[model samples]
Target: MITNGMIAPVNLTANVNNLNQLQNKATPAEAAESFASFLKNALDSVAAQEQNVHKVNDQFIIGEANVNDVMIASSKAELSLALTSQVRNKVIEAYQEIMRTQL
Candidate 1:
């Protein structure tokens, strides 16, 4: 029963209402805290992985671990650290870009 232009008006109104509701939900401070918590968790995970690698290396040194096991653990820890550094670099770059944007 509706024309295409009429449907477009209804869709636009619904989208605007949804966007308003989403904008009202969270303050900037809350969002910043959530992001900080996420970063802390990521750092904790990386540290845990490094600790596991150290344990594997210690065991290998004492002749209590298999060579292949130590090698795999070391590689995994190296990759995790490398990936974490890359993510950090990307985040910093994004922040810099945002700062440079004209308001």
Candidate 2:
């Protein structure tokens, strides 16, 4: 199972079962709400990482944090932002593709 702050092997069978349950139970409105909340949470996480980078850099300047910590924080923030940008691009592309469908 996916839990906080640790890496472990995922049970794909369990995950697929849970996903099937969600698909069966959720209405379109519920799905939309879920998607919106997910996007908001992801953006919030990205913002938090960016803020952490700044905080780490400040601490490093005062010799409280090490260069390694600062570098890692910066890298995490950069990667999160890049991932968010890519997701946005993919979502836009999917929407455009749907719009272009001749149905």
Candidate 3:
């Protein structure tokens, strides 16, 4: 258990070594690309979850799924999609604001 206000010291040499390995294996551009790809994947996952909820509802309509399960899945998917959209909107707003800065 971690106590409040207790900061653990990180080993700088180990961190440097890890960074060296990462730098050796990938350029800065490659790292940025990987990060962007990861973000895209996360967005895709949110959309997929929404699709799955709709699918469950469709299954229930066709008499292949339970009502309770469909409702639970749909609520979960809806909440996830809403949260993802909010985060995306915030990020876009921040980026636009940054672009508006003249320095």
Per-candidate TM equals 0.68, 0.76, 0.65
Please give the range of 10 consecutive residues that has the lowest summed lDDT in model 2: 2-11
Which numbered prediction scores highest in lDDT against the true structure?
Answer: 2
lDDT of 3 by residue, 4-103 (tens): 1211222237434544555555578876765566566666666776777778778889997787767776776777778778988999999999999998
Could you arrange the candidates by lDDT from highest to lowest? 2, 1, 3
What lDDT tens digits, residue by residue, belong to model 1 across residues 1-103? Answer: 4332211111235434544554454788765665566566667766776787788778878987788777776776787799889998998999999999998
Q: After superposition, how far is residue 36 of candidate 2 from its true place, in Å?
A: 0.8
Q: Where does candidate 1 stray beyond 4 Å?
A: 1-25
Tell me how many clashing residue pairs each candidate has.
0, 0, 0
RMSD of each: 17.1, 5.5, 11.4
lDDT of 2 by residue, 23-80 (tens): 6655888766655665676677777778777877888898887877777778777877
Q: Candidate 1 at 33: error in angstroms?
A: 1.9
Candidate 2 ranges with C-alpha deviation above 4 Å: 1-24
Local error of candidate 1 at residue 31 (angstroms): 2.7
Regarding lDDT, does 2 or 3 come out ahead? Answer: 2
